[model samples]
Target: MSPPRVETVLIVDDSLVQRLHMVGLLRQCGIHGILEAVDGNQALELLSALDTLPHLIVVDLEMPGMDGVEFILQMMKRNVMAPLVISSNRDLSLICSVENMAQALEIPILAAWKKPLTKQHLAEILHHSPDRPPPSHSTPETHKEASSTGAHELALAISRHQLLPYYQPQIDLKSGTITGVEVLARWPHAEKGFIPPDHFIPLAEKHRLIHDLTLEIAGQAFAQAAHWRRSGVHLTVAVNLSPRLLDLPDFVSEIDALLQQYQLPAEQVIWEVTESSLAADLGIALANLARLRLKGFGLSIDDYGTGFSSMQQLSRIPFTELKIDRSFVHRAHQREHLRVILQSALDMAHKMSLVTVAEGIETLEDWKLLREFGCNLAQGYFIAKPMPGETFTGWVKTQNTRRHGRRGS
Candidate 1:
C-alpha cells in the first residue's frame, strides 16, 4: 500500500512545553508539516499570511493576551474554515462553553481534548476528519446572498414544506441488528441546497414556528414508520422534543392525535428531551413527560450527563432511556476515566431499567467498546449517515439481507 498522506497542522499555545508536547504527539501520528503560534494574534497573522491554510488547527483556550474565544471569533469573522481542536487543562464546563461558542459562531470543531493530549485522541480526530468535510467545502458558497435566512424566511420554508425529516439508524450493539432510527430535521432550500438544522432550529424557536416545524416532522416520521410497518420493518422512530413544545398546554394531546392519525402504537415512538432542556421549569416539563410516558411513548433523556442535576432529573422524570452524549462515547476508547464513566452510566441505566444508547460511534472500536460495556444501542456515522425516507428504507432492506446472510453462512 502507498504511504499515507502527511497532514499539515497548526498548534497555538502560550506555553513552549505545551506546544512542544503537541508537536511530539502530532509527529508520532505521522503529521510532518506543523506550524506553531504563541497567541491568538500571532495565529491570525499566520493564517492571513499563509497561501494555503493548514488542514487542522490545535488551539489553547486560556492564553496570555488573546484567549481562544477571541481567536475563534476572529476566525469566524475572517470566514476561516479550517477544523479546530481545542486542547486545554481547563475545567470541563469551561471547555464545553468554548465548544458551544464555536458552534454558535459556525466554526468547524474536529474535537476538544482536556489537556495532556494523547496520540490516540489525535489519531481519532484524524480518522473522523475525512468524513466531516469543512462546511464550506461540503457546500459551495455560490448562494451567499441567500445563505443566512431569518425567521420570516424560515416560517415561509415551513409553510412551503421545505423542512423535511431524515432518518439515522440506531443499532443493537450486541446483535449488530438495526433497532430504531432518529428523526433529524433538514431544510433543503432551492437556492442554498441543504441547510443544516443548527442554522434554522434556533430561528424557528425564536419565531414561535418551532411547534409547527416539530409537528410537521413528527407527522412525516409517523407516516414513514407506518409504511415500514406495512412492509414488515417494525422499526421504532424517535423525534427530538423542544422545551418550548413541552411547555405547550396541549402538547400531549397533539402527540396523541398524531399517533391516532397514523394508526401507529405510541410504544413505537420515542420522544427525546435533552437534559439541558429539562433543567428549566421541571414542574411543567416533568408533567408533560409523565403524561407521554403514561400514554405509552418512550421518553429518553438525550445527551445524558451534559447538563446540571442529571441524576436529579432521572430521579424526578419518568425517562425510559438514557443517551450518552457523543463527547464521552467518542473518547471512551482512549481515556480510561471516560471508559469507566461510560461503564458506570450504562450500569446505572440498566439498574434503572432504562435502555442505553451511545451516540457518535465513529469507529468499530467504539461500537465494540459499547457492546462490551453492555450498552443496548449505538448510533452515529459508523452505522450510517441520516438519509431521506426512501433511502432509509433501502438501507433497512440491505441490513436485513446481510443479517440473514450471516445466519445462513
Candidate 2:
C-alpha cells in the first residue's frame, strides 16, 4: 500500500531551531510543502500572500509579537479555517488555555504537544488530519478580550443561557442501538462561539455557580428529552452533577421540579457524579444521592477507576451505573493490564448489579473488547461526538437505519 497523501503545512515559531526541528519531523511523516513564519504577524502576512493556504499550521504559544493566541484570533477574523497544532514548552495548563481559546474561536485543533516534539506525535497528527473536518468560517458577532479564567464572564454566560448542552450518544453494544445521550455543556458565546467546559467549569465551582450551571444544563437536557419522547424516540439523558450541587439545601427538590416541569420521568434522567466528588462530605452527598435514587433517577459513578476510594464510594452511593475511565478503555484491546483493569471494573459493577459503561472507546477494537467484557453501555467519539439538540434527532435516525441495514445484510 502507498503512503498517505501529504498536505501543505505551515510552522509558526520565533526560534529558528524549533522551526527546523518541526520541519524535519513533518518530513519524516511524509509531509512536504512546508511554509515558515517567525511570528503571528508574519504568519498572517504569509497567509494573505499565498494563493493556496496550508492544510495545517503548527504554532508556538509565547512568540514575541502577535503570539499564538493572537494569531489564532487573527486567523478567525480572516476566516482562515486551517487545523492548528500547538507545539510549546509552556505549562500544560497554559497550553490547554490556548487550545480552549482556539476552540472557542472555532479553530480545529489537531493536537497540542509540549515542546521537544517527537516524530511519533507528528505522524499521529498527520494520520488523524484526513478524518477531521475543516474549521467553520462563520464569525462570532464580536470578539471579547480573551481572559484565561473568566468566572464573572461565565456567570453572565449562564444567565444568558449561552452555556448550551450538547448531546453525545451512548450505545448498547449487543443491540447496536443508541440507548441514551450524555448532556455535555458548551458555552456558545456571542463573541467566542463555543467555549468548552474546562475553561469555565472550575471557575463556576469556585464561585458557587456550579449548581446553577448544572441545573441550566439539566433543564435544557430535560426539554430535549421531552421533545424526543414526543417525537416517538425515547432516550435517557445523562447529566453530570457537581459535588458542590449536592450540598445545596434543596438540590433534590430542584431536580424534581425540573423533571415535573418538563413532564419527563425521573427514570429517563441519569445523574453522573465523579468518585472524587463523592469523597468529600459523603454523609450529606450520600443523603442527597439517596433521595435522587428514591425519586427514580439513574445515578452513575462517572470516571470509575481514576478516583480515590472508588469501590467504597460505589458501595455507599446508590449508583445504578459505573462508567470506566477512558485511560483504561482507550487501548484495552491490545494491553492485557488495561484489559484486566477494565474487566475487573465490569465484574465489580456486575456483582453490584450496576450497569457498566466504558468511556472513550475510540476504536472498533476497544468497542469489541468492551462488548466481550460485558460492558452494558459505551460512549465516546467512536459512537458519536456531542451534537446540538437540533441535529440530534436526525443523527439518531441515521444511526438506527445504519444499524438495521447492517443486521439485515
Candidate 3:
C-alpha cells in the first residue's frame, strides 16, 4: 500500500498536456489539492495570491517565459521554503546541475526527474520529502540540535569541555561489516542542548581556536578507539583534519603525541581532509600532509566531487581513500546521470588504488546500488546515524546480529 500522500501540489508547465498528465498522476496517487500554472511567471502570481503554500511544487525546466531556473532563483530571493520536484526534458546532466543549484540556494529539492513523469517516480519523490521522518532512531536528535549564538558562546563551551565526538560507522560494502567510523564533533550545550558542529566549527576556525578544538576532539576520538580496541572491536577511527591545524608547525607532532598517549597504532586512525582546506597555505599543508602520510596514518579526500581542485589534490596528496559526497549517492539509482557519475567516480578511485567511501547512503536501494558499484566503504543514515560513544558498541552488536541472521536465513 502507498503511504499517506501529500495534501496539496502545484504543477507548473508550459504544456497544458504535461500539466494535465501530472495532475492525473497526483490524483491517482490520492493528492486532490492541485494547482496549475502555464509558466513560471504565472506560477509566481498564483503563489502570491494563495493564502497558504502548497505542500509540494512540481516544475518543468523548459518554460516559455521566466524559465524554471529564473523562477527558482526568484523563489530563493523571495525566501520560499516549500519543497520542490523539478521535471525537465532537458539533458539529465543539466537537470542534475539545476538540482545542485537549488540545493546551494537553500531550497529543499525533493527530486529532479526527466519529463513524462510516472506514478512510481512521483511516489518516490513524495515518499522522500524532507517532512518524512528519518529511518534512523538517532538522526532526529543529532540533526535538530539546538543552535549556538556566536564565537563567544562557542569559546566558552569549548573551555568547559562540552565538545565531544560522535561516531558514525562506515560499512565495508563487500564484506557487509563495520570496518571504520568517522569521528564527528558534537557540542551538547548545558542549557541549550546539542549544538551542531556547523555552529561552532566555523567559529573555532575564524577565531583561530581550530587548533585547540581539533586536538580536543582528536584526543577524545583516540581514547574511544582505544576503548573499542580493548573490547575486541578493532575499527579504524577517522578524524577530520582542519587546514588551520596544518598551518601550525607542531600540528603533525601534536597528533603523533596524542596517538602515543593513547598507545593506538598510527595505522588505526585516518585523517579526512577537504580540498579547500588544503588550499590554505599550500606549501605548509602539503608538507604536513606528507609528514602525516610518512608516519603511517591514512589520508582521505573527503566530499570528493564538491571540491574545485579535487583532481589536483589527488595528484599532490597521498590520499588513501576517496569519499564520494552525499549529493552523488542519495538518489543515484533513480537518476541515470547520477549513476553514471557515481560509477565513474568509483572507477577512478579504483584505478588510483584508493578506497572509495560513499557518504549518505539513506535508502536500501542506495545500499544495494553501492554494493553493485563495488564502493569500498559506505556511511550515512541508512547504516546508522552518528551516536554517542556509549551506544556505539551496542549498535555494532545489533548490526552483527542482523548480518548473521540474514546470512543464516
Error of 2 at 122 (Å): 9.5
| Candidate 1 lDDT | 0.86
**lDDT by residue for model 3 (303-348), tens:** 9898799888899899999999999999889788789999999999
lDDT of 2 by residue, 1-409 (tens): 2464447889999999999998998887777789999999999988888766677899998999888888988888898888889989898667866876887676788777789889876776777675533433434432334345388888887888878889999999888888898999988777766665666788788888998899899999999999999988899898999989887669999999999999999999999998888556667888899999999999989998877889788767888998888878875664566777888888978998998888887878888998998999989988888899988889988988987888899
Ranking by lDDT: 3, 1, 2
Model 1 RMSD in Å is 4.4
Question: Whose TM-score is higher: candidate 1's or candidate 3's?
Answer: 3
Candidate 2 Cα misplacement greater than 4 A, ranges: 1-29, 32-125, 129-149, 407-409
Supply the TM-score for candidate 3. Answer: 0.90
Please tell me which predicted candidate would have the highest TM-score against the true structure: 3
Poorest 10 consecutive residues by lDDT, candidate 1:
131-140
In angstroms, the error of model 3 at 143 is 14
Model 1 CA lDDT for position 300: 93
User: Where does the lowest 10-residue lDDT sum fall in candidate 2?
Assistant: 135-144
Which candidate achieves the best lDDT against the true structure?
3
